[model samples]
Every structure is written in structure tokens, then in C-alpha cells.
Target: MSKIETSILVEAKEPDTETLLVLNDIPLDEQVEGLIRNHKELNITRHRSEKLALSSGPDPTGLKILPASSRQRFEESGIDVSRGYPEVPDRSQIPVFVDQAFAIRNYDLPYTERGKNADKDKKSLFGAATEVINLTKNVGTEIVGLQLENLTDQQKDELALLIAERVVVFFRDQKLSPKTQRKLGEYWGHVEVHPQTPQVPDLPGVTVIWNDYKIKQGMNLNYSNNNLGNWDATKNPAIGNQVWHADLVHERQPAGYTHLHLDAIPGVGGDTIWASGYAAYDKLSDEFKQLLDGKEAVYISAHGYLDRDDPFSGPKKVERVHPIVRTHPATGWKYLFVNRAMTRRIVGFSPVESDLILNYLFDVYEKNADIQVRFKWSNTKTGYGTSAIWDNRIAQHRAVWDHEGKDARHGTRVTSLAEKPYFDPDSKSQRESLGKYLHKWE
Candidate 1:
């Protein structure tokens, strides 16, 4: 199909630090005053260049300290003497925050999603040559030679479009921190915050993806506990363990783009697999597609809890009705939306009939080698591992538990809630629209 895409690699010629993501701890207005007040070495009135380099320290330890007399000023809010000074950062590299935007908050608020027009910015935002590797013809793309932290707002928007078209786009060697990742999710849409889920202290929407759901254990410091990998290849995949589903299907506005930045991964098998919804929809017959279009189905939450009022009763699952054959707002293509794990039943069918149809659909997704791509969570030279950002609007994903908890796996996820599942009657299939070559068997 589409002439078997191949991976291309381009060596990075020159690196630029000005484009790197920065915390911007020092505000421009306070920079001079704080430096003069805190450090007695610098002349306050000295002319500064756009970019400044600090004079190297004379000591073998490469540490700098303010004079003893300046210790009195440290008691004030802007100054601190408790921590030793790390190297001074270049002034030009600091990020500028526009005061106009709202600060990130935990509470619920209305937000709109982007990429409605599906206008993909195919041109590289950085204007740098990069290795673009397509894992498969229809799904999964790996962007090498560029760091996620170096992207601009326009670049991030372009990246979003790329994810919409490719199903999932991955990046290696990303230096994105949890706070920055949450900020990135905020830029995409209203960040979906799970109060029950463990989160970073200040960052509300970012969910910790530690193997064990415990946070009090001091960052899995007691490594003896979380080493059990859930998936066992010897046995049939446990429905509870290897469940394939989209995130937040039970929410009124389900997940759009869910980004998982994996910082810790096993030496062997913690790879994740994603199936292309567009390709899955294309594989169905015209009659089967017609049967599913405009139909509604029930989706249940992954984790269930006891109802506060009915403690004696069993756990109750949260269920929501969504379209069976849904259309992605960006691509305008219909995809089969039901998953074996979360999706329960077709609205108008008998339980017997629904199970038969759903089993076949799940087979279509699970059995097909052509439509699926498995990503190895391999790290780059930086050793921090990879970041995978996928559109939950039109794809299903599953984590391979084969790593068996023998090793530790850790990550932070930020899910951006998109619009409710919808169907566009006028939209067409990807194969039909693009005139892609069908496999010999198809």
C-alpha cells in the first residue's frame, strides 16, 4: 500500500540552544536588581549584551559564592543562599511568558480543541533536515533528529496535525519534564485531570504512569516491590492485563491527544502497540460499514469503584454512550470506535448479536498484522527514553506487559480532552480518499 514507506535518516549538522525550552525562573524586570542585590561581584550599571557568558570560576570545584556580607540580603524573598549557585544561564535563552494567558489550574473549565480544519503543516517547522521513519504505511511515525523541547507554538501545532494524520507520532531524546509536558497538554486542550490518579504536587492534570500506582513509596525507591510485569507470553493475554482501549472513553468529552513521556523502561519488553482506526475501517466491507455508521454504543470506564451510597453492593462502572462509527474532526474520516475492553454493547442489538459482531471487529483490529505497529520504548543517546503522542479520537492502543515488572517502568501522561465522539455522514474512508493500493489478499 502506497509503496511501502521507508525510514530516512539525516545527521544533525548544527544544534541551537536559543530554541531549547527554558523554565525562565528569572524575570527580565527583576534580573538586574536581583543580581545586584544577591551577588556583590557584578557591577549593576555594567552594559549587558543580548547573550552573556559568565566568567569561569577560578576554583577546582567550579562553584561560585556571594560574599559573606551579601548573606544578609539572602533572607529576602528574591534571594537565596541555602543552595549553591549552578552556572549562570544565558539571559537570551530564557522563555518569555505572556501575562495574557490563563495560568494552569486543576478545576474544571471550558476549553476548545484545535486542528478542526485538518490543515496539516507538512513543511518542517524548524527548517532542519530530520530522519522521518514511518513504522507502517498507515500508522506510526518516528521523528528523529529533533527534540520536543525545542519546538515553537507553531511547531507544536504542526506536530498535532502530524499525529492526527499518522495515528501516533513518536520522538526520542526528548528532554521534556512533567511540568513542561503538562504545559504542552494545556496548549492542546483542557487537560484531563484525574483526582484519584497520583499526580505531581503542583501539576494537577499530569498523571503519573508508574508501574505500581503507589506514590508514597518514595519514587519507587524500594525497587523490590514493582518488578512484576503483568503480561505473560506463555498464557493467553489476560483481558484485565492486555486490554486494548482508548483513554477517557467514559467522559462526556473523551481524550483527543494523550501523550505519554516514558522516562523509565525495562531492558527488554515494555513496548506498546497501536492499531490504526482508519485502516481498520478501510478493511471492513461496504455492508458492514453501513451497519455501524450512525450507530451508538456503550463505553465503560476502565477502573470501577464502589458507589458511596451503596457500600454493600459491588463496584459500579461509569458508562457513556458514544457513536459506533465515529469521524475524526481533523481527518474527516470514519473509524470503528468500539474496543473489546471499554466498549460494552451496540445500542439497538441483542447481547448475543452484539457479542458476535464485536468479537469479529476486535479480531479485525487484533489479528491484522498489516494495520498495526508496535513501538519499542527504546531511549535515545540521552537515556530518558521516548515520548509517544497519539490521537485517541481514532485509534486503539495496548501496553505489552511482557516486561513483567522485573524492571521498573515509569512515565507521566497528559490527556487532552477533545470534542464528543461524532459521525460525519459526508466523510469518506482513508483508502477511498487517497486511492491507496490494496494488499494482494484484500
Candidate 2:
């Protein structure tokens, strides 16, 4: 009975092509049109015979203009299009590495063991260090009065040793850029280029640590479900717990020193907790230790790839088998290397049997609060944030998503690829070496 016209005339330009006219099917409400007209970035060119609309921004080099998916998403939910269109990476110039087979990345690229000749009687770092605050009994240590970027070679070496012993070390007031952070990681060993992680455009090795940029509206960064690795808990995919995991366990040579320099943080909340692998191992019964000593488990990548063995099955995760128990080369101490997130199934064990034993080990790590240290991040938009450089070899860490990513929690992380995971039968446990014995029933 009636011929109808719609709203929102968005003029977009395609790369190497002519201009495109994009519009909505239905007419916009007057209230929504008023909001669009008021936005400084958006302009009302003209809409329909009965309604007004908005014009889109022009396309730039390597980034062709597309329909504002973000704007559409928000508008459908009764939100005004105040933010800008989100830009997706072309990934043609710089792409993510997905085929992370052990053979390709397993080759050695100059890695010397840290703390090999450590001085046991170390009190200060190059005479400028004021304190080494042990945040907890077993895991975290915060070094004060020394900046990470300005450390001498010897100081860095000692710091590496400290990290090897402490599991994780903290540094405050670092003003290092992504490149500087990359340089710092180079001193440790081979900086890893993550298989499927987004890197700093200019710097490929350094990864943006806190990835909450699902919908970037103007200056705002909306969060996605940061609780990724945790599988299930309550009915119908209830909010699963954050996973406790070591980074890059799927690599041929796994991650060693991981430096996360948080540049921005929330006013409060969003603390990360790390559990001592040594303590987790010690918490186990002697009999269980004997069972898992030399055994290996399959660790699948957090970024899954199509299983080459079974291509018909949708996206099979890349897997690397590593010892369940590994000894830290620098500390020469045995620690429980298996994590709750990635360590899938033990080798030679039936599916049910692997779940039974691995679940027990996971419980031992997750249930013990005493063996863990929770560190609250203190960094803001004003300056560089607090930094945590942890030895991933003997630690399992989980980010507390209590803030649910409402606040800005972004950082630059560089993970140095250490030697292949190894188990030494001669190495003693941290407790055994330090003579800290406990009487407990497991």
C-alpha cells in the first residue's frame, strides 16, 4: 500500500574501487538521529524522504572503509553510534604464525642458562637497590629502587637468578616502550614471536598483553570474555574460572622469562595470582612424585589450529608433549610443570585415567592458596605501570578478571623462548634444598 524509504546514508570508499552507498533498511527514530548529528566525528549528510542520516569516514591506505558493524551492534541494542568504526588487521603485511610445529621452532638460537654462576651472598643490585620485598613466602618478590631498563649486565644476570629462585619478580616505575621492552627481553634470551598473537605493528616480537579491544568506540575499548581457557562449571556454560597456565607451553622450546609491563590499570581490583610449581610438587605425596617423575603430557596451544592428523575435525589445537615434572636449569630444582589449562592428557594413560590423575594434580595447584601469591597491579594512563617478570618455567599464573575489563589494563609483554623443557632426576625440590619440611596428609 505504501512505498517506504529508510535512514542512515553512510558514504564509504572501497580500496582501489569507487565509492559505495551504505544504508539501513528501516527509518531511524528522531531521538537516535539527534544523537548522531551531535557526534563530532559523525555528520548528518541526509537520510530519506522522511528521516535524516549519518555519513561514514573515508577509507585510508591498506584499510578500506566498511559498514560500521560496531555502530550497528550498539544501535540495535538501543545505543547511539558515538564511537568510531573498528579497524581489523589486514594481516597481509604482517601475519600471525599458526603452523607452530615443534620442528620448525625447535632449533637453538643462543640461550645461556641464567643464575649459572650466581652469588649466593647478594644483598643489593649494583649499589642502587634499596629493597627486595618478598611479596609472599614462596612466589613473588618486588625489587625496589632499580629500573629494569637501566640495569647492568651483571645486575640483569642476578635478577634472572632471583626470578629463577622466586618464580616471579616485580619492578615498578618502568618507562620502557614496546621496542625497549623487546630489547630487555633480548638480553634474557630469544624473544618469542607468538603463533597467533597480535603484535605491536612496528615491533613484531612484543605482544599487547591485555587484549580487551573487542569493540573500540572512539577511545573506548570494550571487553570480550577474558575468561577464555576455563572450560565449564555451572549449568549451560556458566562463568568458568580463569585458568592457571604457563605461557607458550605448546612451543617446541617453551617460554622462560615473561615480562608484562602494565601501562594502564583500573582504580582497583584486577590482580594476578601465580602458584609456585615447586610448592605444588612438594605438596604431592612421595608415591605420586614417583609416578609422574619421567612421564610426559600433551600441551595444546591456547590458539588452536586445524589438526593435521584429523583435518575433517574442525580446528585441532597444536600439541607439544613435555615432561609433567621439569627441573629449572638455573635453580636446579624440580617443580610441577603441568598446568590446569593446557596440559591435556598424560602419555600412555587412558582418557579416564589421565583425567583422574591430572585432575588431582590440577586440584593440588589450584586449591593451595598458601603456595600462591596474588599481586595487585598499580599502573595508570599517566605513566608506565608496574612490571612483573616471571620465570614461566616453574610458575603457573592466572589473571583475576574481577574487574571484568571495565578498566584499562593494557601492557606490553615479551616472552623469551628458553631451552626445551627438561627433567633432571638429580635435582632436588625447593623445599628439599631449603630444608623446609612439612607434615601433611594428601
In terms of lDDT, which candidate is strongest? 2
Model 1 per-residue lDDT at 407: 67
TM-score of each: 0.68, 0.74
lDDT against true structure, model 1: 0.63
- Cα lDDT tens digits, model 1, 242-328, are 456778787777888989988766779878999988888889888778888999998866544334344235434567788988887
For model 1, the superposed segments whose C-alpha errors exceed 4 Å read 1-111, 117-121, 212-241, 307-311, 437-442
Candidate 2 per-residue lDDT, tens place, 1-442, comes to 1212234334447764443233445333332332333332322212111121212231131122222322232244353223332222222221112243344476666788766676654544636687779998888998877777788777778888999988999987666666667888998889987533444444557765543442232212213544533442111111222567788898888899999877666678778899889999999888888899999999976543333344335434568899999998888899998876678899999999998898888878888998899998874334556889999988888888778666755666899989888899989988989988855666
Residue 438 CA error for candidate 1 (Å)? Answer: 6.2
Off by over 4 Å in 2: 1-103, 124-126, 215-241, 308-310, 379-382, 440-442
Residue clash pairs of candidate 1: 227-405, 228-404, 228-405, 229-404, 229-405
Please give the CA lDDT of all the candidate structures: 0.63, 0.66
Candidate 2: give the clashing pairs.
307-316
